[model samples]
Each structure stands twice: as structure tokens, then as C-alpha cells.
Target: MPAPTSDLASFAIALAEELPGSWTTEHHTHAQYPDQFDRAQHVWDMNLVAHAIAEHVLGQDAALTRDDGTRLYVVARPRHGEEFLIGAIAPSGIPAEAFRTVREPDGIAVPDDPVQAAADITVDLLPRYDKALAQVHDNAARLATTPAPELVVITLTGRDFHVSKPERADAVQVLLANGCVFDKDQGAFVLPGGDTAAQSEAIQNTAAQLSRLGVGLTVQPSRTTPALDTAPATAPPRTTAPAARTR
Candidate 1:
């Protein structure tokens, strides 16, 4: 189907979902009658019917059509409290008075106006999206200030654990979540002596989280390995655009 027609179909379905009452699509066939109508003529007649339905029943300015030259119609019965009944003019070569009543599927009630319905759905989903974004930002910030592996060393004399040059936000969130604290004077994440098991577990958890976020960890040289000059890296600043207001 042409892109515009496809888009119209999508729009119709979305609109239908929001409107009150049930909706159904019907295609009229004239094959049963012996009088063979010209295809072009039939399409023209159907277009007229579609326009009438859109204007009188749907209260819309224009009719929506498909790529196959089929006229689209939305048939609905407005509920008890509704001002007007919703129904469609079938393309069965019959008069609009001969319109048939189709069953409406159960659906959520929506506002009478299509634009208002769309706005309602947008309002409902925004808070969830904002919460997820906030979480991502927090995680990113934590990773940026974390210490590197080479800097994570235990001094033999004091048994003080140190983490150096931690740069990834995700990594830092994992460490912080797993009970690691920063030491300003030592310039590292310090885990006091006698908690080797807990320290190891924290490191392992940080590695797992970093892997999930697609961030690579820098391995720093410890007492056993030669220390490399690893520089601390900062996460890029993030900015969020304000949500557009509904007028």
C-alpha cells in the first residue's frame, strides 16, 4: 500500500481505539447482482458514500480511503449517555437508510474528541518514560566517578582496599549498590581489612552490571601486577528537553 494510505489506516485504527462504542470494517460486494457495474463507477459511488458517512455520522471534515480504492467507514453506536449514535453507511449499493448494525468489541472508553483522546494517551505514558530516563541518568553518573581496577589495591601494612581512576558511570552504580564507599583522603573506594569475600563479591557484581550496560572496565595494576598510568574519565553531560505543553 502507498505510505499515505497506510498512515491513514493506522490513524483510523488509533482513533477508533480512543472513541466510545464498538467499531468494525465492512466491504460491500456487488457480485451477487446480475447488473455488472463499471469498477471506476463503483469506486466513485463508494467515495460518495464514505464522504457522507464521515460528515454526517463521524462529524469529520474528510473521508479516509485505502490503496485498493476501497472507501473506509467507521460504524459505531454511541453509548447511553452519548449525544449521537455512531454508524457507518455500507457500500452495498443500497441507500444509507439500509445501513446494518454491526457488533462492537469491548474496549476502553475514550473522550468524544479524537485530538483529546490522543492527548489523554500521551499523558498516561509520560510519567513511566520519565522515570526510566531518570534511572539511566543516575546510573551513568555513578559510573563516571568509579575507581579503576589497578587502583583497587590492598595495602599490605594497613590492609586498606583502594580503587583508582574509576571512570564509567555504570561501574560506579554497581559498586555503590553493592556497598562500596569512596575515601577522599585515600582517593579510592576503601573496603577495610577482613572483608575479602565481600570486597570480591562487590567487584564481581560491578563487572556484571558494566557488562550488561556495554561498558568496558579498565584493569589497573595491583601489587602483583605493574601499575599503569590510568587516567580518570568523566561521563558526558546529559540534557533533557522539556515536555511540550498541550494547548
Candidate 2:
């Protein structure tokens, strides 16, 4: 016979109350493959693991799905004779899943005291939860700072052009090889200046070269020296530009 509905409902009620969330329950039955003995055996073994020690005591296993779609399985026969074990059956693909326990040895045990277990789990996981959240924020910050190939600034100083640093090492070397000097005072790579027509041509050629190599350049008069034109670097262009001539 299936486990008493009252017993399942009672356990779910206790956990839901402790967690204080909208939760719904479902009867979980192990899938059987009558035509395939090996498959059936494998599923049975997996179910045994999923149900934990509660298989024999509960006579049936069940799951609780939160309003947010996170599922926690019921372990009726918790080790140490605890009343029930509420834990994830699989990774829920959510932040909570990172610290939420399972039925494994390393997983947190849900004792008879559902309220206390909930509190303890919160306390135990707070640091890790905060850390996980922090890591996500840190990654976003890194992405925000990533170089924008399209915003490569080329400022026309009195004589030469002051170019902002490109993130690529190869791009840096290319600039250095083409008679560019790193000016510490200006914090930009200085390109030699010449006749107006020749300088314009050279700048355009260099810009095109950089563009081919997945970099961009924006030429502006030196009056805008203090700020480098910048934008969030998106994925490089898919189509190739014609081979750029060395300046």
C-alpha cells in the first residue's frame, strides 16, 4: 500500500511552515521498464538512492515543488530516526540549489525539529550563499570592464596622435612596431605626426588595420584628451575586413 496521505501531508506541512513558502506536493514513484530488466533494475537502484532510508518506512516517496519550481524530495526514514528529510532530488539550476543539501553524507540532515533544521541550514549556508552571490556580482563587474574594440580612441595631439591602449597583446605590438611611442605623461601610445594629408591617410590606414584585427578606432581632436571614448566590448565582427597594410 502507498504511504498514508496524512503522513505525507503532515511532513510537507511541517517543512512548508518552517520554510514559509508556497509549496505543492506530488507522489513520486520510481519508473519501471517491464520489458527491459536491466533498465528496470538501474531505475530501482536510483530510486533507492533518491528515497534515502525512507523507502521501507514510508512505503512511498514524494516531492514538494515550490512556487518558484524548486523541488525538494521527501526522505521519510531520515537517518538517526528523524521524522523526515527535505532536500533536492537534483540541481534546481537556481542560486539556492548551490547550498541546498541532498540525501548524501555531506548533505545536511533534517531532524525531527523541522523549524530548528531550517534555521540551522540557513545559518550554516549563509557564508557560502553570500560568497556565491558575490562571485556572480564580481563576474558581472569584470564583464562590464572588458575592452570595447569599437571605442579605440585615437586623439590628435599637437603633432602626433595619442591612441588609447588596445587590450590585445598583438595589437599593442603592432602599434609599437609602427613607430609608436608609449608616452607616460599622456598615458597613450603616440604616433608620429607629419603633413596634414599624409597624417590623415596614415591614421585612416592604421585604423582600418586595427579594425581588420577586430579592433576599432575613433579619431578626435586632442581637445577631448582627458576622456577616452569607450563602450562595452561586444563579440567581434564575424565578417573579415580586407588585409590591412602595415603603416
Candidate 3:
């Protein structure tokens, strides 16, 4: 029912498809950076990503929130397989263990080798995660250059849906078995740890919880907060930060 904070990949996909006007880009800041691989550069890059998502995906003064009181916000980067930090938002703000979490403390029964057990734990799932990571990469590419004004991060924030990608779907199944929270909205597994059913249940429970949080189902007004700097008139509106650009 609340907005998704951990669902950055969705935002990235949306940004790639939406956003408007020409925008600039830069790097992120890092901690130990006297050179190109410096942390400062990383931080700078992340900021640019945040800007891109804010301007391109969400559009002007647009954002979404669900009912369970889960809040979603726009940011520059959502954690993915380290390709481009091209700005995004996630709906975390679902903790790692928000859904069903399984602990491997007793240790999974498998060959004594740690590598084998770990591999066995996800022998069928590695490919899925890899593919999902790849999709995220593709999404990053699209968001960087998309030129649309009405950006909307499309995602199914509920249960009973399936990832179209085979590998990703497999990984979701595996991760669910491993106690990871595979958020349908976020796509990335909430490995605190996530898996398939957790992912499914997150959406279902979220919808159910959000139902009663509404003010008689009349639609709440936007919470104009987060912006703080002078920006382009067309820039996404922000309360304490810039709002993602949308219609």
C-alpha cells in the first residue's frame, strides 16, 4: 500500500522510458579517492543518477505511495550488479526481512564442500540472478538516454505475479527458499534474505495492509516535501529533495 523505496530498478526502467529535455551528467563522490577509482567519483556519479531519475522518470512533482504505510521515494541509485549508478529509487524504507526469511544456520545438507553447498544452494538460481542483473544493465542503458516527459516506473507491487525472465524467475524461487525477500516492486532480492513466496507475499500483504490506511479511499494529496535548491522550472518538484519528473 505504501510507495516502494527499494524498487530502484523499476524506477530505472521507467526513467529509461520517460523523462524529458536534455540533461547533464557527472560522477559520484567516494571516500578514498585521489584518482579515478576514488569514492568521491562514485558519490558524484550516484548524485547524477538521482538527478536523472528525479527529472526523467518521476516527472514534475510526481511520486507514489502505497497504503501499508510503506513509503517509496526517488533516489539516484538502487543497488544492482555494479554497472551504471544511473539514478533510481527503491521501496525499502520493506526491511530486508519484511517478508519470509530463512536462516541457513543449521547449514543446508549437501556435499561437505562450502563451495559445493553454496553452489548447490543456488545451482539452479545463479543463472536467474545473473539474467536479472543483465536486465538491470539494459534498463540502465535505456534510462540514461530516454527522452520522454511522462515517466512512470511500472511494476507489480503485489503477489501472484511472475518475472517474465526465466533466469530471474528461477532465482526468485531459489532465493525464496533461501530466506531472501524478492520484492516484485524492487526486483532485486531483499536478501535479509528473500525468495519467491516472500516476494509474492510482500505484494499481497502490502496491498491488504494499505487498504485500511487510506482516508476512506478518496486519494490523499501529494506530500510536497524534500526539495531545497533552485532548479529548472521544468525540473521535478521536490519538498526536501527534487521530485521525480512525470506528468
Candidate 4:
């Protein structure tokens, strides 16, 4: 069968399509051997596959069948410019009685349909994208409760306020979320609106929040000096009255 994309889900599906029945999937990087079995045997086989791949072997396929009819199909393929060895073990032929004594979870689920088995494997192997989305939602909810900063200008001119340098990054993030903009020229953040009592209150509240983070927003005179003209001055040109125009 043609190789699938580097995505683990697609890889699982491709491996499933090549299989004849429900089988457990295994990878060299994400190997989860059954605890009930002798893990050393599986690890040895896994190492063999890895060694072959490291030697630049491609399209290598092999099968191992136990006396009980349980079989393992190992295949090596290149993934993301690196070779990876994957295996699928068919344990359907083995009698369920063989595992009756093991009360612990096998952790590997093999659905009757190979496709579903692959889907299950994919779900287990992939990162928790849903968890990440929920985290983003939580952050948004928290930001929504933060006071919307007043955009008016503060009364202090030629003065700028800043948090402690070490905490600038985190403080900047909080200020920006509350509708503040960084003024590179002023070397400090400028609120979107200012010049009212509300502006002063907003600054005080923001400062208070930053204080909890061990940083204080304090005002200081602008350190940037105005540029001086270095060029020599020229005399102003004398202008004569325009000649009288003919009627």
C-alpha cells in the first residue's frame, strides 16, 4: 500500500487498510507494550526494526506468529525525513482464556473493524487539542472580567509610566488586553484614552494589579532628549516688491 502522510492519524488508517482484521498498533517512539506479556521480547523485536531503519532499510516487512496463532506484522517507513518502524499485532486468534487471569487493563483496545481500531489508536496517540481550546476559552473569560482601560490621556506630559523591566513582558500583555498601546517613542505604554478622572483610576487599578506580580508602574520624566540641529544657519533672503503690473 502507498505510504500515508506523516500525520499519525493518517498513518494509522493506512496501516489499518493493509491489515486483514482488528489489530493493535505500535510505534518505536510511542510504544505501549502490554504489561501482562514479557515486554523484553517485544522490546527486542522493536529494536531490530529500529536498527534496520537506521541502516537505511526501506519497505522492510516481516511477520511473527506465536504457537497460539497471534501474529505481529512489522513494517518500516520514512516519516518526516526520518525512518520509523511500526507494527500491528493480531491477537484475535488467541483464546480470551489466555488473558482471563489478568484483571488489569490492557490499555490497548482493538475494535472489530480495523479502521475503528486505527481511529482508537489515533485518539490515544494524538495531543489533546480539545484541552488546549478549553484553556484558550478560560483565558478569554478572565480577560473579559478585567476592567476596560480608559483611553484618555494622563495629565502628566513629558512623563511616561512603566512597570519593572523584568516584568515588562507580562505587564505589557495585561495592559494590551485592557486596551493599552505601547508607545515606543515614550518608552512606556499609553492607554487608548486618557485625560479624565476615569483615566487616573484606571492607571491606579492597573498598577495595583501589576503590584501583585511584584512590579510597580511608576512615572518618570522622559529620558529621550530632543534632537539638536547641527547644521550651520543661513541668512534669510531679502525680498523686493514685485514690479508694478501694467493695467
Whose lDDT is greatest here? Answer: 2
Candidate 3 lDDT at 198 equals 58
lDDT of 4 by residue, 1-247 (tens): 3534544444544555644445444333322111112221221121223222222213224343334344444443433233334332313322222211111111232333334544653564212322332343453455446542222222122122232223356766667655566667766556532343454456666656665654434321111211122111431222232221110
Tens digits of lDDT, candidate 1, 54-110? 122121221234333223232222222321112221233332111111111111222
lDDT of 3 by residue, 1-247 (tens): 2222333344333432232322222223322111211111111111233223322322212122223321122233322322223211222222111111111011122222223323443443223333433444454455447532211111221112222211333333543553444566855444231244454344333333323332010000112311233223444333232222210
Per-residue lDDT over 75-142 for candidate 2, one digit per residue giving the tens place of the 0 to 100 score:
45533455554444332222221221111211244556656655654565333434544553453455
Quantify all predictions' global Cα lDDT against the true fold. 0.33, 0.45, 0.27, 0.35
Candidate 1: misplaced stretches above 4 Å? 1-158, 218-247
How does candidate 1 score on lDDT?
A: 0.33
Which candidate comes out best when scored by TM-score?
2
Q: RMSD for each model, in Å, please?
A: 27.8, 24.4, 20.2, 27.9
- Model 1 TM-score is 0.25
TM-score of each: 0.25, 0.32, 0.20, 0.23
Residue 196 Cα positional deviation in candidate 1, in Å, after optimal superposition: 1.6
Sorted on lDDT, best first, the list reads 2, 4, 1, 3
Which residues of candidate 2, in runs, are more than 4 Å off?
1-6, 29-58, 91-106, 125-247
Each model's total of backbone clashes? 12, 1, 68, 8
Worst 10 residues of 2 by lDDT: 36-45
Candidates 2 and 3, the one with greater lDDT: 2
